[model samples]
Target chain A: MIENVCLGQYIPGSSILHRLDPRIKILSFVIFMIISFMSGNIFSMSILILSVAVIILLSGVPLKVYFQSTKYILFLIFLSCVFNVFYDYGEAVFKFWVLTVTLESIKNSVIIILRVTSLMFVSSSVMFTTSHSNISFAIETFMKPLSIFKINAQDIATMITISLKFVPIIFEETNKIINAQRSRGADLDNKNIIKKVKSYIPIIFPLFFLSFKRASDLAVAMESRCYNNIIKRTSIREFKISILDISCLIYIIVILIGVVYCEYLMI
Target chain B: MSALDIKNLSYIYNQGTDLEKIAVNNVNLSINDGEIIGIIGHTGSGKSTFAQMLSGTVKPTAGKIFLYGKDIWKDYKNRKEVYFKVGLVFQYPEKQLFAQTVYEDIAFGPKNQGFSEGETEEKVFEALDFVNIDKKLLNRSPFELSGGEKRRVAIAGIFAMNPGVLILDEPTSGLDPISREKIINNILSYHSKKRGAVIFISHFMEETARISDRVAIMDRGKIKMVDTPENVFYDYKSLKSINLDAPQITKIVSNIHSKGYNINKKIVTVEKGTQEILRLLRE
Candidate 1:
């Protein structure tokens, strides 16, 4: 059941998006996220959404996987849409008791849904195309300027890489603990809220203990290998921006311009 | 009726995905009450997956699992009852320990079984005794225990459930020889006392041959053979073809028999092998 979580999971492929440099992918993701949120009207939002769709197609990752990742946040999207529909700023198109549905409110909710979905699809696309180590490498390169301020970019990168690596491992450990408890008659599907919450005690406690134990073991292993965070480490694979990366960046820039023009038109 | 009957049992992992794998495939077996069945397989032979299905922790993709003539998956609402009837001690079960104290950890299963408070305590003590754990450590945190002790405590937690079919996956892996012997003895005593069907999954041929009434060999998600230990180990060549070895005693006796020494090749345990050799020397 935990296998359905696609967040931060990388799918290997030889697609155009996969070939792009990690730094370029990370930069594009941030830019896309910002522009998607800044989108004010349907035209601007549609432009961003169209670009995301194109990116997803180039990613070579199945559309079902992206949908699975967004499924986890569907409730949040629905909640925000409901709140937008009830906001008292617009002229009411219909009234049922205390609830008010307005023309502008409906339009705002549609924009909100589109904005959130496009943001999720863009992030998932980036994650699917870029490996975790590449992400850490990209982050380290990006954070290199902070080294002048006495911050260790390599250490931060290592921390991020380790945590990212543990996401799947922790999921596997939780699955094992859940099966063990279930074999011993844990009613994890109990209908009562209190009982259901209490049933997770077996799963949560063991998972936390196992994770801590694993972390300590990892520390000891690193110490034994003479790993010193103070020493500067060189990466084996150096990031080089290829023609594909530059073109992708140009494409994103064009999409940003189109979205800005649409926003201006809306104003 | 057989205590545990599996018919065409199958399990597929990640079905329909590119990573799809047939973990257990079209297997059939019947384990009688009060019987001990040993399952030996190489890593990824689907032994663990098959054990999980037998305990109803994992539902098979296609097939039926019957616990004493009742289909475990027939009634979804009462499927939880199968957990009480079939207890599974996972590989390296020590990681399953969670409660604050050893007592509480063992009691968790019986309590979940809806046993009364007094019955839960009694069952916990009985489980501790079955696993040969010290009662003085009842109040101590399970995390503070040694590796072997933690493993024992974890097994005791499952034992407290008093399941009719106990499935243990590699229970003695990574343990000292003495602890391994103690665990085997505890399992034997538990089976004798409870008269429940025991399915022991392991990579160790000697221990499996020593305790099992019948041994089942699995290769690539299929059960290659199931027979008495003596008969199973007697055919060492077939076992070797599947990347498995008979117990050392069986191999030695078979080697002696091949040398025209008139020794019995079906010897599986060390004691029986010794007895056969001694008789030959007397002759």
Candidate 2:
């Protein structure tokens, strides 16, 4: 039941993006995020947008999916735009009863909207292109230095992996609970906001209880399987940054330098 | 007249998308009053989906369903009335019990249907009595009960509504043999007393054969065959081909028959097989 949620759904492909080691893909995504946020001028921001388009093409994931992912956050985008338009102090270009809109404010609002959109797409692409297992392995490798600080990095990584795994499980449990309630004449949908919030009691309480029960069962199952907290946990496939990775890293670094210098000139 | 009649029923989940799945396909089926029918299929064979459609929990994407010659989905507004008339007991339904007392949980359905306070109280006890859940445990929280008891309470919750057609999806799953037998026997007793039509969806072939008056074998969102248990079990070859199998005793008895030990092909119960085998040995 929980499997129905298609957020960050991966599209399998035989393209070069699909063949890249997941760790390299993850590190590159982080660099992409830095470039996206640091883009100051429209020129560099347009380059960032172009890079997203290129990556989407290379990943072989459809553009429709990118729009679908953005659909979930459309409310926030709209809210930000509305808030920036009337509230920001600037020379007025248009006037209503109490609303004053300006070109500068509009430009600022568009920049924020673009930045947010870029952030959403960048993170989602990482999720859509790479498998969760590889991301977990990457996280473990990335946190290797934390062991020196007397923290159990392996445990943290395993926890993150299991939590990611249970996101679907929780959703499934929620669906079951909702269906059970619906069968009892509980109308969750097509109800007013007040009624909807009240309807959530039936869904939420059962889900919360089941989640705890599942966690207990999982803990017992884990103990039965002899799970350990060993830091040097090995995997079947090891991640190694190759020449291809270095070249890609250098290319992104050059783009970042050029974009930042261009933004400086714009200012 | 048949208690429930489903004609050309079809249902699809997430239609018009890549994830579209045909859960139930054009299925025509009927259930007479006081009859106990078993629906057996592998997981995702559309047994549960069919049961859900019959229980009015799922609206068929196509076709018509008549309960007592009246269209069940006549109007969208009175859909809740349909739900009340045809009760559904989902798999692991016990997890839905959240009331402070088992009595309250059982009465919740009846109360929702607009039954009076006194009538609701009596119906709650009646449901408790029907399921054989002791009256002493009625005031206690359902969380304190064992898994089997909780399942019974959940079933009782639906039973309080006294639906004319009862649909249970995999009711015996994930339980001890003794609990499973008790639950099945309780359902049988309920059917006998109430004279209501029952559709028990299960994967346990042996129990289904023992209890069912008619068996519907489903495979890949379609009913492969529907007939009396003896008739359906006779075509063991085709049954297996569609990911279904006959009861083990039927196979053994058929093997015995092939050995010139004259035994009836219609034998369903182990006791009957034993009697036939002894009769053959004596002859």
Candidate 3:
């Protein structure tokens, strides 16, 4: 019953992006975030956008799926761009009824929109290429230093992966609950918001009940499988950063340097 | 007059996409009032999809369905009436019970149809009585009921509406044999008492053979054959080719017949086979 959306969807492929170490992918994502926030000029924004496009193309994820991933948030990107336009100080190109469109504002707004889209696509590409377990391992590796500070890194990573896995299960349970209520003639077609909310009681209550039941069953199953946290846990597939992954990281670093320094030169 | 008339009904899942599947293919079927038909098929054989389509839950991509000589989907506005006329009991329906009390859960369908409060209560009581749910359990929370009791309450919820044609999809799955037998008996009593058509969409060949007046054999989205249980089980070879097994007794009778014994291969149920064997021994 769930629509196939690109969000959190891992596309299976043997592309370079897919084979990259999860640590490298995760590290690269942090670098991308820093660059996105630090980008001051259109040049930097264009560099980030182009890099994102190239990585997506190489990741073997269809362009359509990437767009599908960003489709829902396009409205938010547009809103932020419009908000950015109003906050800019520049010569106005168009003005009407407390709304002003300026050349500088339009330029800044374009960069903002592109940056948001780039951020969304960059993260989605990582998700599409890297499986959930790999990302969890990456998170654990990155947070290893925190273990010295007494943080329970293993438990945190296990929790994140479990929550990620349960997202689809919750959706399925919700669908079943909705269908059951609907079959009993639950009137979801009410115009009143209160009435609609009331109608959802049948769905919401059952969903919560069923999910709790599933969670308990899962807890039992995990216990039986000996999923208790250990001091030194070993995974089936070891992640190693290869030359290909390092080279890709180096190329991204080059783009970051260009984005930062070239923007300074332009200013 | 037929209680339900289905003409060339078909449903396609994920149409116009790479993952598209013909869940239900062109199928023409009709059920008479008070008739009981058990549909047996393997997974993905379109049995459940056919039941969903018949109950107006899933719209058919092609052809038409006429309930009591009226096109059920002709106007589209009468969908609620259609739903009421064709009640559907989904598999694992017990998980749907969210009402505080079993009585309220059973009254949900009747109340949804805008029955008067008294009338809803009357129907609920009658349905509870029909399912043999003790009146003392009516006021208790549905959550507190045993698994079999909960399932009976769920079935009672649909029974309160008293649909003209009832459809149950694998109702007795994942239950003990005694519970399964009780549920089957309850279904039979309900079907017989209401004089309403009942369609059992199931994978249990033995259950279907024991209960159904007519059997519909489905495979790969098509209804391959429909006939009396004895007639359908007579040709066990055709059934096996469709990835279906005949009832155990029928197979044993067929095996005996193949062994030079003049046993009737059509004796599907245990009682019938035993009686036939005893008669042959007496001769």
Q: In model 3, how large is the Cα lDDT of residue B73?
A: 78
lDDT for predicted candidate 2 compared with the true structure: 0.81
- Residues A9-84, candidate 3: write the lDDT tens digits: 6767799899999999889988988888778676777788779889888898777778876787988889878887
Residue B35's lDDT within candidate 1 is 88
The CAPRI quality class of candidate 1 comes to medium
Residue A95 lDDT (model 3): 86
- Model 3 ranges off by over 4 Å: A1-3, A76-95, A98-109, B61-63, B69-74
- Candidate 1: deviation at residue A226, Å? 1.2
- For candidate 2, write residues B116-135 as lDDT tens digits: 99999999988877788899
The best candidate by DockQ is: 1
Kindly list the per-residue Cα lDDT of model 3 for residues B36-127, writing each as its tens digit: 99999998899878887888877799989989988877855766888888889987989899899998899989999999999999999989
Q: In candidate 2 chain B, what residue range of length 10 has the lowest lDDT sum?
A: B75-84
All predictions: root-mean-square deviation over Cα? 1.6, 2.7, 2.6
Give lDDT tens digits, candidate 2, residues A1-267: 112435665556577676777778778878887887888677898887777776777776666677776676966797978788886477889899888899888888888888788777767777777777777888887888997899886788778877877876677677777777777766677558997897677678767778888889989999898887853667988767777667667766777877788787656
Provide the DockQ value for model 1. Answer: 0.63
What is the DockQ for all candidates, taken in turn? 0.63, 0.35, 0.45
Evaluated on chain B only, what are the TM-scores of all the candidate structures, in order?
0.98, 0.95, 0.97
- CA lDDT of each candidate? 0.90, 0.81, 0.85
